[model samples]
Target: MDYSKLLSKTVVDLKPSGIRKFFDMLSGLDDVVALTVGQPDFATPWHVRETGIISLERGYTYYTSNAGTVPLRRELSAYMKRRFGLSYDPMTEITVTVGGSEAIDLAIRAIIEPGDEVIIPEPSFVCYEPITRLCGGVPVPVATLPENDFKLTAAQLSAAITPRTKLLVLPYPNNPTGAIMTAEELLPLCDVLKNTGVAVLSDEIYSELTYGVRHTSIAALPGMAERCIVVNGFSKAYAMTGWRLGFVCAPPEITKQMLKIHQYAIMCAPTTSQLAAVEALKNGDGDIEMMRAEYDRRRKYIVEELDRIGLPCFEPKGAFYVFPYVGAFGMSSETFCERLLNEGRVAIVPGTAFGKGGEGYARISYAYSVKHITEAIERIEKFLKTL
Candidate 1:
């Protein structure tokens, strides 16, 4: 009868996701060309799916070890070393979780105490700030500028840190803006972080989706590995969103603590997914390249089309979304997207859904087909004419 009084105030007060808000608006609409979701349009590779099916056929429906199967962790260890040049003791440092979302939650919960301030670069993936609040940590959002390609700056990080600083969430090959931090760009932020007692949660879920440049993990940088918790998963890279699997690699001391949370909360990632992920790490390199090449093609087409339509877009070198400035039309980001959806039947997310720093822009995911994107952009062009 009084559910509001019974609910956790934090959960009650948390705003629903801005992305979902717009997506829900499309439920009853017909003939809408939507570019709102961040997931790849590609299905999971056939081999990867067959691996899971094979495991099920063998009746391997039992639970796994709290950290996941040893074979999976070992393969994950080798994959990390091979792809990113980062080394972690598979037995001690890596714990498989339900997804990258859970790994991020475990990392934040493990490190944050009440009043501990976590510095987040805004216009990022939507989870970090609200998750920090749930952990009783204060979220300090530093706006990354469009002029700087939305990359978090060393100066910004240095200024944001205080004696109470506990963590910095580094989400790159970032969501919403598609901004990425190169090794050289990350070096300055790393410099500022040295000896600060602040840990880094590097969310590299889109690591394999960059165009024209290889993904660099901040964990691979000198002295950074010990202080970083690297969270990655198969969802974006392998089109394995439904698998609900991911892993976190951190120093043993830190992971030991995070494992306690995972053990109590999740038990383990899905057994079928773990076995399939091993196959993905071992033989799915070709699948990654094939899908990434297609994403790169769509990325280019959407960016060019948006610019051609007079909505100046920042060329995204990483991730599969393009954020174009929509301020010239003199509407708030939400209003711009809402009007487009209602009047033009083109669906895109408003940047303000990500954070206040995203006020003047809107995010359009290029994760759909070239044909789907073409239709959406053509509709956008017509919408702009009316504006």
Candidate 2:
């Protein structure tokens, strides 16, 4: 029982995910509507699923190349260039991992040394901070304000940088907040980064889900591409989360180191999933549009309804989540979500799960059907009345 001495302090010291704290309590509860998970409500496109089935039928079940299947990587390279104005050499610059989560880990591990600083924008995804810490990198969380639509401004980026800074995580079309950064917005940040050696890890997993405009990648900026690692996956856009497919596109120099860790840790991403992803990259543009249209409808409806209900939610132009300020109810985000689940039977994540900047806010995902979203809104309205 003296395992404490043998265990890595880093692992022990790492906190559990804040998003799961309340979700774990919903076990065995009936009639509870959970908007906690960020997975797409739609099924994986039939063509993409069919490819995986066909691959299995054809006995294409062996491990892929550590960098992933060449055809898949080629398709991913082309997809990235065409969709996001970012280019990469498929053979040498891209590595398919288990999911976007692995891509995050791989990129951080490759670039960071002990005591190296990585700037993270909060009220964003949950993994960047913990993953950076796991790699012995110090995480400098920059608060993304509601007024700026939760984007990491050039001023914030400039403030967080020092000589020891090694990386900045650019999480846009952001999770929890759903804020997007247009190219105009990114140009100033690019100016700040031009002469600096600070590398950027741009997580564009939700790139395809933008409502009013296309997702912008900092890598597309001139000179910025040399300093950016782009992480994307089939999970959010292609609705293939369970298949667990993702990739990282960076300079060959960085990819070389990342592939080393990935080689020893994970020989390759799943064979079936890689095959399926190829189909998604090649022919799934239409599927993305169809799903984005539905999400846009739901996004608009939920934002309007929440504001109408006096929650004063900021309109989100990207991703499927709507974050409404809940401090007016005189409760912390945790207390608000706890009470809503107990009384209204609706499960939304407390914004604090994302980071400190997320306090007094709650993340409500609109990935559900309109009917389901409407019902949740009604329940939320009733809960607010009781306040």
Best by lDDT: 1
lDDT string, candidate 1, 1-387, tens digits: 899889999999899999888888999899999999888888999999999999999999998999999999999999999999999999999999998999999999999989999999989999999999999999999999988999999999999999999999998998999999999999999999996999999999999988998999999999999899999999999999999999999999999999999999989899999999999999999999999999888888888888899998888989889999999998899999999999999999999999958998999988898888889988999999999
- For model 1, give the RMSD to the true fold: 0.8
In candidate 1, the residue pairs with backbone N, CA or C atoms under 3 Å apart (3 or more residues apart, or in different chains) clash, namely: none
For model 2, the superposed segments whose C-alpha errors exceed 4 Å read none
* Model 1's TM-score against the true structure: 0.99
Against the unseen true structure, what C-alpha lDDT does each candidate score? 0.93, 0.91
Q: What is the per-residue lDDT of model 2 for residues 67-168, given as tens digits with 9 covering 90 to 100?
A: 999999999989988998888999889999999999999999999988999999998898988888888999999999988989888999999999999999
Give the local distance difference test score of model 2.
0.91
Q: Return the lDDT, model 2, position 108.
A: 95
